[model samples]
Target: MTQRIIKLGEGYGDVFELFTLMEAMPDRVDRLLALHTIKNDEERTSLACIFKPTNQGNFHPIYICLEGIPKPNDQRNKRYEMFKALSEQFDKPIVEFTVPPSETYHEEEQYFQQIIAVLRLNHLLPPI
Candidate 1:
């Protein structure tokens, strides 16, 4: 199956767009993931939604909001809070983990490829 990478803008505004995509296709939502990483010595999170592949096509699209949310609970970030709320609304728990920052990779594509590998190895995503 082919997986499409869709990246939206950062911060709270972009979160609305992510929610809208989910709202439009509740049944397509397969799972949620929260990737935690340390960037510039601060804890950050990347919220992602892996939607099911098309029944008639070999496309599995993952919508991700990059490391814009603060991971610390003591720090209030409405964007993360909104995502948390929606996760509860859909009853899909966020599968979280700490990973190497994007800077560690030579390019953004390499970073995402690593993530896909992890997802497939764990069976969150099917082997192609």
Candidate 2:
């Protein structure tokens, strides 16, 4: 199985798109993630949703709104609140982790690979 991160924009509109994707395929939803990080001295969160691999294509796509929302612990935001509501609707707790910010990586793909490795290590995702 191949897993890839598909980044949505980093803004409110992008978050809406993420929610739309979830609503469209609720059955395929595997995990809801809140990746917390400190960037430029400010705490931010990346909201992501992992879907089960497609039956025919075996492609696992992780949809993400990267570093867009304020960390819930620091300040509550409407977008994060919407995510929380989705978590409730889906009956999945949002899994959270503190991770290196995207700036730590030379390329965005490297950053996503690191996150995939972490998920696999924790048994949240299947191992390669």
Candidate 3:
């Protein structure tokens, strides 16, 4: 039940990389959740998909896209719009986070570790 979060940079190529990462982790994840923030929209949208379990008893990994889309206070972007459309197809609402992007972590591993720590603190991630 361990949960981890990773953020992608606001780059055109990042979307593909993130997609590939999530697709490769289907056997290790339990759920996939994606959040997209679109411009001109007052609210955000999320899409979640549940994948079949693996023969090794591993669940599909969940993925959330928190990049490219501008914050509520910032200007809108096309990436968010794309995510919003995908979210609708998944039928999940995108949730808003009050916390801004972390500046201390320079590596994706560090970012994921921080997210895992937060999930553990909130009891959202299983203790291992």
The worst-scoring run of ten residues by lDDT in candidate 3 lies at 42-51
- lDDT of model number 2: 0.93
Candidate 1: pairs in clash: none
Residue-by-residue lDDT tens digits, candidate 2, 12-35 = 689899999999999999999999
CA error at residue 90 for candidate 3, angstroms: 0.6
Candidate 2: stretches off by over 4 Å: none
Segments of candidate 3 deviating more than 4 angstroms: 1-10, 16-69, 72-75, 120-128
Query: Model 3, residue 83: what's the lDDT?
Result: 48
The CA lDDT at 28 in model 1 is 92
- Cα displacement (Å) at residue 69, model 1: 1.2
Q: What would the TM-scores of all predictions be?
A: 0.91, 0.96, 0.50
The Cα local distance difference test for each model comes to: 0.84, 0.93, 0.46
Q: Write the per-residue lDDT of candidate 1 for residues 1-128, one digit (tens) a residue.
A: 89766777557567788888888999999888888999999888888899999988879999988786778478777777777888898899989888898889998888888999998889999989
| Candidate with the larger lDDT of 1 and 3 | 1
Each candidate: how many clashes?
0, 0, 8
- Residue 12 alpha-carbon offset, candidate 3, angstroms: 2.2
1 Cα displacement, candidate 3 (Å) = 6.4
Candidate 3 lDDT (Cα, whole model)? 0.46
Residue lDDT tens for model 3, 14-76: 665655654565344343444344434433433333333345634323344444434433566
Better of 1 and 2 by lDDT: 2
Superposition TM-score, candidate 3 onto the true structure: 0.50
